[model samples]
Target: MRNLLPFRSAPAPTSKVAALAAVTAVVAVAAGIASAPVAAEHTDAHAVVRDGQNIRYAGLTVRIPAAGEGVQAAAQSTSGDISLTVTRSAEGKLVVKTDDHEHGDEDHGDEAHADEQAEAQAVTADSARPAAAKTCTDRAYALAGWKLPSFAWYYNPAGAPAAIAGTAASAISAGTNALSTACGQKRLGLVPSYAGQTSAAVQVGAAGNCIGNDGRNVIGWRAGSGRWLGMTCTYFKTINGKKTVTGTDTALNTQYKFFTTTANCNNAYDLQSVVLHERGHSLGLNHVSQSANASAVMTPALSTCSAGKRSLGLGDYQGLAALYGTR
Candidate 1:
């Protein structure tokens, strides 16, 4: 079952996309979650702060190998699709850094600048631009074929029920429901699998210590294996006190708590919302920062829960259709 979360007006496209394109061009770009905490509030900027504390990114990062010229070449080729950049370091390791341009602004504070620089340097050290793909839409379909059925649930019971499981069960259920409502029964059984189960080990509190920083909440797979792994966190009492933790990460002690207080550890968020979103990633969908379809689930940021956009929007569906050939 899909849990209903509030929706908000889609925010205007941020410069992060453009930066991502540029960076991805330079090197194949590369490209989570916790809690039953409430859905992340929409923000105009890339970073979101919760409860006057804690911070997170509207987008996630996918890391690529820093070793071997072949791997670097593949990263550069794929980077263009995600609008991210790749860089190689002296050690011949590749780091895929997000194209969050707002952090580059002088007014963002020294912490922000330092963070951006660190990311840039890390990516540059071993990253390379991904090769160009036919189109974002096409890539989505091709990637969808490669993904395994997957789902994410919070570790806290106070959070949405589905997001906590991070299991194929929730993902399959959500996919069936969403596809049924979107394309009817024609595409019912076509839902992919969520393989590649991994976790994004993020650090709570402080600037550089956000979700993406900790490398928790992120997951990926090589061209084959048909498995998709993503980063996930365990529930801890210091975070979610309830005996039944339905979410991925703990409250208060996790990145979600440090970033926004609006997210309730026990309730407030939707499981289907995050599952649907992350499932998109599992299916090869990238963040859409260039489109005007603010209501689209693939839009770069979710500004509100009132928009009733917990599911895939038109652009998202269309992108999928283009990639996989509509069933």
Candidate 2:
């Protein structure tokens, strides 16, 4: 069968108009010299991150993903970006690929837009057919190559609420285990081993925004606001001319409440389900449309107290198989 997932597109070329505007602004600054006050805008979880910024860690730069680049899977509820990966490029920049879901003022018109985008890019039939014959169910998954057979990650539950802190480790591990075993009996060789607790801080900015990759595989909770529920930043580096996975850090937004048990759910998000989805991104899988494949763990959005994502769906499995061959 043909692969039916969207591949990461190349970095967007700098637009001429924007470039010219930037040049004009720079000249104005040069003319003013010391006369004007200079204040650079800081990028945080709450700020809109520009595509190419000099946020550095360990000598590597950052490459933020363009908005609506893949699948057009906007948020079904609550505006937020989901399933983002940060990896090193050939030039040693951390290429960030994200599966984002937005709501509120940045609305995506309607679901029809998402359906239209998905249908336009997807391969529906085995042979060429008229555009009118294509269906929205013909969807695509996104993949990033992983060179390592296994990755070890450490967790820090320092800021997690007491309500579920005790069970956070096991609950989060279930999410990792779900992805490791997503390929079923054919078992893909990819493994996510828990390396116990660590004093290492998760590399998230004060407002819960993802910071530069710090070359440490750590997971923890941080206080944050805005629509984001969680974020995973995967670090990569060039080794022998190949951009390979180096490390990853994940942070859950303590600003939003989470529940581990059914009774205490209280309309909060499921801890395991959210982690499973984030782990999917860490495993090199991108978003599938929530409308098209709502059951898939890789879908861009989730609802409150929903625990169904703790298991992988068919498309989820197919995505894993595509990247790492089934055993």
For model 2, how does the per-residue alpha-carbon lDDT over 12-124 read when each residue is reduced to its tens digit?
32212211111111111122111222222212222112332322221122443222111111111133233333332333222232232111121121231222223222322
Best by lDDT: 2
Residues 66-158, model 1: lDDT tens digits: 223111001111111112222333344332223332222212111112122112222211111112222222211112112222334222222
Candidate number of the best TM-score: 2
* lDDT of candidates 1 onward, in order: 0.28, 0.50
Error of 2 at 294 (Å): 1.3
Alpha-carbon RMSD to native, per candidate? 18.2, 11.7
